[model samples]
Target chain A: MDIKAYIDSGILELYVAGALSEKENKEVYDLMLQHPEILQEVLEIESAVIKLTSAAAQPSKTNIFSQIKEKLKFGNKEVKVVSIERTKYNWMTYTGWAAALVVGAGLLWTINQNNQLESAVTTAEIEKAYLEQQIEEAKTNLAATQNLLNVLRDREIISVPLAGQGNFATTYAKVYWDKKTNSIYLDAQGLPEAPEGKVYQVWSLTLDPLTPTSLGTIDDFNTDDNKIFAITNANESQAFGITLEPEGGSESPTMEQLYTLGVVASAP
Target chain B: MQLDTLVSQFQKKDEKAFEALYNMYSASMQGVIYNIVRDQDIAEEVMQDVFIKAWNNSASYAPEKGRFFTWILNIARNAAIDKTRSKAFKNSRKNLDAEYFVDILQTSESLEDTTDAIGIKKFVSKLAKKCIKVIELLYFKGFTQKEASEALDMPIGTIKTRNRNCIKELRTIVLE
Candidate 1:
């Protein structure tokens, strides 16, 4: 290669422009390394280009390198992993998670409280209903007792005392016959509870022929709160008796099961 | 430190080497950026951005590709040209019709204050009109031999030889 011809060819000037292809750039780089003259010429062309380009600039008042260093975080690279901004951001993240957990726990507590309150309200409503039912039952009992007192005190009513029979001597009862109402109020308070499949049958009796007329069986004897029962008796009765019979009561009194007998005091 | 050693250290992310490189080339980059954008503030902004980019992409640079100065000069020209095409830059700067980089030498009062600018001012004044256009296209604008040949309406050989003579003249005024 003619070194002077290569130098005079103006390729070195174009090399400074960075306008060459990659192959041409590699060729120029290799040539500059092998030859000292080529290297010197390239350096001169590059220096002149630098001066010419620098002439176009208006010399700025402030150096922008510091601003660039700040942008690139150049000097701060070693300390970047432990940067205060990163620490602050991590703290905020942890605080956010903690806040979320607190809020979640608060929500769970509120929900639990709400559920407990709802159940308490339900229990209170059930208790209120039970109390109200008890009040209603007491009122009904008071009214029934007051009406029974008025019936017993009436002057037109005839009272009879029934004595318990042989096997049930301790069991006693009373009958108040209200002729005006044609009804008898039987107070069987002293009577024992009727056995299953057997009911106490009341009968209106006459002593002339000892005839017994069946009234009716006491079906609700076990369930009645007060043992007082009102029964219609339109027959002209001189006496009354009670006997434990079958569930529906018999046409005639069962003599073996007679529990009580009473004679009307004002009877003819 | 030697330029090659400093550049090598810069590529390895040495902050001191980066600063050395920045101080050496920032002025030239600003000049090339100013010529394309024709505004000092925008030129400075683009110049800073160019250096920051060079730092970030330092690993991509190789001596086999080109000189470090040439590499950064290419980045500055492209960044400045991109700035001119931006909507904000176009709206702010209605007229950026400078024909050559040397035009700043004649018209700019901004350079009058700096004593360091005197030598370059003399060089630009003594530079021929043809040299100004050729250098502006080749070095400042990063135009290829074919592009510059088409732009100057001359043959590729003439552009190369003319650029050589122009750089030779520049060496006499500035480098010699």
Candidate 2:
């Protein structure tokens, strides 16, 4: 290859401009490596272009270098610090999880407390109802006892003991008459229970005239706890008699079925 | 020193070699950038960005492709052209194609401050109008031979030879 002709071809100027194709650039690079003259010529061409273009600058901007260095320094340091700070934030993440777990446990405990309070209230309510029922039963028993005490303590009451007669000789009864109040209380403690479909009726009698007046029947004779009953007496009764009758009381006493009889003693 | 060794050290994050490379080429790169952008501030800003880019991508360079000066020159020209195409540059300067680097060289007040400014002024003043357009397109604007040929309306052969002779004259005046 003729070196002078190659140098005069003007490809070297384009080579300095970086305008050559990549293959041509590589070929030129290889040639410059092989020949010192080609490399020297290329260098001279590059120098000329640099000087001409540099003339267009107003002045050399040598001061901007420090600013560029500063930017690089800040950028590198910021990246390093950001990574370190990110690692430090791991503790905050764990604390957040712990707080959530604590809140969950507190919520569960509160629910359990609510359930226990509700059951306790239910048990108290049941106990209160049972006590109320017992109070009602005691009140009934007290009223019955007071009625017995009042009958026994009356000043105008006359007590008469009726001995069992005839077929029911072993049966007995007593009558307490409160003539002022026009009431009589019959105590049939010694009497046997009447058969089914039968009741015991009381009678106020005047034995001189043999007249009988129906009092009332003992309807719940078998179930009475004290076997005592109160009946009204507006008659001028000389005696009292009891006889077995049908379920409801008869109009007059049954003489043949008289179970007990008693007479009131005058002024005694 | 070989440019490959300097670039290798630069890729290894050697700041001193990077600064050495910046000192050697930043002025020339600024001139090329200012030629297209036509503003000193914008030119300086683009020149700084170009060198930073060269440092960031230092490992991508290989000497078997071209000269290191040519590599950086290409980067400077591309950055300058990109600035001209930007919306801010176009909004501020509308008639960029009307002026060339020769006009900047002829009008520069800082020419006296440089060591070879007088020689560059004389060489640029005596440069043919065609030679100025050819070098402006080929080197400063990073145009290929065909593109420069098309822009100047000259034959490709004439563009290459004319550019060769123009650079030779420039060497005689400035590089001597």
Candidate 3:
């Protein structure tokens, strides 16, 4: 075969540009493998064309390879088992798998950590709500105590302690009477919790006649937090007493159920 | 690495070989596609898709049918043409007037990155007006001998020989 004639024929140039038919391409492919010179000519032509075309290309963006690798699901620093058939043990493969496993474990740990943190936040929220409720209760108690302190500081108000009497000697009670408001604050804290189906009754009495005025019944004795009751007392009272009654108070105090009695001091 | 070996490895999904092949022809492919697409950003996008498609369909490539460069070039041209025809693309580019690749090289200032930039710029300057049209159609546009002959209104023999001589002059200026 005349290699020189084939070289000068310009078919090699057309072949590389793919301007030839299939049969012509096959003929060229066969000639390339058979003739070293023919192959060399094709290479030279291809190389020149590559440069010429490259001259026309825009400068590519950075890291195009890594981007392509990422899209192909190939990790940057991890080994991907691209094919199961190839069993060659290489350092890169082991390192890649190890890195992948490490990343997987790291992800799992992060997720577990996040879950624990979320639960902790929820627990803190519940505890905060409980604490807020306790604070509110404290504020109410302080306000009630402050009001009681103000009543005790008033000079016109009279305090009468009704000590336990008769069979209920262990029980005692106190009343702060403010004649201006016709009201009395009964400090029933000294008394025990009222039993079921029973209420505490407050009474005002005149010393000479020993006549009693039915003030009112302490129906909410058990539910009161501080066990303090406020009663209205309009009568000129020389003494005060407390007695245990049924769900509803009787028209008069029950004598056997009488818990405490106290006399008012003479006016200064 | 030898072109044959590199191509065979690329067909077998060797990443390194694929990179080597990309480095070799991507610029040239970009040039060709840019000539058709007429937009730098779209041309680059089309080039990437062309390479990715080549990698995905590597098995379909047969040396007996064509050169690897030719195969990828064909893909790039078709993809760019397809992009141009897309409704979205057509809406943006309502008037994609006819302009040769030389117009790009002449207008572009980015030729400094290429090693043969000076030579190509010089060759393009001194290149005949007829030679420019021949290379544009026969090579950059992937026109066949017969298609080129019909398009250029020249004989098939004249198209081939004329393309051959144009390439010959290009080889002298760029290769030397």
Candidate 4:
């Protein structure tokens, strides 16, 4: 068998690539020991393959030896005596990785913490608006009560205590008449809750003539927390009366449905 | 160290010999693994595992069965293919298109000035598409001549002779 023909047969290339069967490998191994040229040919093909494959690798800064050594725990003692050139390479690659990780982790944590704090601030703002509404309501109530006290203290004001009358005699009311402002503050706290579709209408009356004039109805009587209603009364009234009327105020006072009546004492 | 001495020492669990072999074939193993997995980090991870496995199973290697380079190349290819089968790797890569090893060689940024790099770039740039597939299957992917022949739709003899002609063209360019 000519060795050159065997070399040219391309069987050795497949042999180096390990693309042959086990038996074929053994044959090639025998042939290589017998012939140096075949052996040299195999070496050359293997070398070319090694270079071709290695060139396809991506560029990497990682020192694979150091990584393997770290995993195997074999290089730490020998790490000291490692060449200065390798030490420099390890320094650049390993420390670079460590620093990047630390910075990245710190940024992520801070962003999460900031988001939590922002939500807390939003909740606080909503609570603050609610509290401010309550404070405004309290201030308005305090000012209103102070004005009522001042009107009652006036000597010129006429105080009328309207007593319950007729079949609806359980309800009573007080009327404070300030002749100067022509406004009467009716304290209807003693009045019972009006039935649905019914309202309490006030009437300013002249007692001698038996003439009744409608003032107006209290539409929000049931829902108002402070039942003191302020109605404008410009008439030089002899008496103040309240009676139940349907929905809107009546054209004339419903005398039989009268709830309360009061004669003004010394009308100024 | 000689090829026989180096492999014999490696088989005997000589740490220095193992290190020497790693330095010799690390980049080639990485390239082959990267070609299959198509990810640099995963390729490096698989490359490390292949070497560790080679160390652990050194007793199983027989010279009559194959060359030392061929033996490790088989390990690297097997390990990389196994990684691709894993759920983690499959989920991370939804669409793994078939890419030639020449695609990696064309990335000039990673190209070093070594004779291997220059010769490989020249050989691959000039390499026929059919030749690329043949070498990829037989050498890089460790497909048998029959499997390669069936895959490329050629006869068994044609796969051998064509591979011979391709490597012959490669040696003349690289050996210079």
Instruction: Say which candidate scores most in DockQ.
Output: 1
Score each candidate by Cα lDDT: 0.86, 0.84, 0.83, 0.87
Model 1: CA > 4 A from native? A76-268, B110-119
Highest-scoring model, lDDT:
4
lDDT of 3 by residue, B15-51 (tens): 8888888878777888888888877778877877888
- Show where candidate 2 strays beyond 4 Å: A60-62, A74-268
The DockQ figures for the candidates are 0.49, 0.45, 0.38, 0.47
Docking class of 4: acceptable
Q: What TM-score, to 2 decimals, does candidate 2 have? A: 0.55
Q: Comparing to the true complex, what docking class would candidate 3 get? A: acceptable
State which candidate, 2 or 3, has the greater DockQ: 2
* Stronger candidate by DockQ (1 vs 2): 1
Candidate 4, residue A246: Cα displacement in angstroms equals 99
Query: Tens-digit lDDT track for model 3 on A1-268?
Result: 8988887787888888888889999999999889999988887788777777777776654334445556665546643423323445555788899999999999999999999999999999999999999999899889989989999999999989889998888888899999999999999888888899999888999979788789989998988887878888899999999999988897888989999999999873
Q: In candidate 2, what are the lDDT values of residues A53-77, reduced to their tens digit?
A: 7777776444567666765673453
Question: Model 4, retained fraction of real contacts?
Answer: 0.72
* Tens digit of per-residue lDDT, candidate 2, span B111-157: 88877888988887778898888888888889999888887788988
Q: What is the lDDT of residue A74 in candidate 4?
A: 67
What TM-score does model 3 score on chain A? Answer: 0.57
